[model samples]
Target: MSGSRLGPEWVPGPDGLLSRHAARVILLDPSGRVLLVRGHDADEPERSWWFTVGGGLEPGESPRAAAVRETAEETGLELRPEQLEGPVLTRSAIFDFFRVTCRQEEQFFLARLAGGTATELSDAGWTAGEREVLDEMRWWDVAELEAELAGGAVVYPSNLPALVRSLLTGWDGSCAHLGEVEE
Candidate 1:
């Protein structure tokens, strides 16, 4: 089997099933708030905490490409190359992750989008089935975002927002540099 893994960089696992790397883009608005979407999965009265907008890396696709695709799909916002940030961490796929006893983590990237109302599009397919899946979209200040996490309203591998808070702490907001945690 002479095939290559997707993404520009590839790593092989013991099973020989190629390890896939994907990227996610988290955009911050001017007030130092971050953008997140309410995951469509929650059926309870409460909604899933806000999530950064983005998706999966396709075959032969770059993390950047996946980020672009996810953002466009989830929010209908098209992102330029200038908007993306760092690839934070590379994680295992869910099935393999549990098999290995560690949750799969996605590579998180920081992004900046021109602030304004996001054009709500489509039927809220995956993130929100019909418009119901998306539930709604909202921006949360660091403290509030943290609060949701503390209350366990949010999900994991999103250990991201906490890290983002740390990185942006004391930031005057003009800085564009992003740091990372290697795979």
Candidate 2:
């Protein structure tokens, strides 16, 4: 078994699946480009995918709190919980990573950089396990992200482009459930 699943955050659900609750950030720049990270399963480095910045919620933490903390840890961007907008989207994702089959329920929040100029992101706060799996980070325009998906790049939440497009216009102040996503 891969050591990735050894963390206390990964617990067994009633179905015997490793389960996790995560809070994700849809961090955007002034130009509407969203930041994402590219990573591979520790046990399958050859297979990589692009995903948002966030992580499993710590014990006794609120989703909003977790989102703020995760953003700071993953990108070195300090943001107060109030700075984030709606848990814009929510979804359940089941996938294999680090040789472990896992189920994660995620809540995504949207936040934008304060200034027009892009803030330089830092990986200095990443945990050792994150450094091992995550290798690249970049901001992507919606159109470019759509193109990449169309061209066969693996991206989480598969509907991210459309989701971003909708959120770019504006969120309806309601959290939309994306149901189950198989990745």
lDDT of each: 0.56, 0.88
TM-score of every prediction relative to native: 0.61, 0.95
For residues 1-183, write the lDDT of model 2, one tens digit per residue: 213454778888888888889999998888889999999988988999999999999989999999999988898888889889989999999898878888999999999776655468999999887888999899999999999999989888888888899988777898889887778
User: Residue-pair clashes per candidate, as listed?
Assistant: 4, 0
- Which candidate's TM-score is highest? 2
Error of 1 at 181 (Å): 14
Candidate 2 scores a C-alpha RMSD against the true structure in Å of 1.7
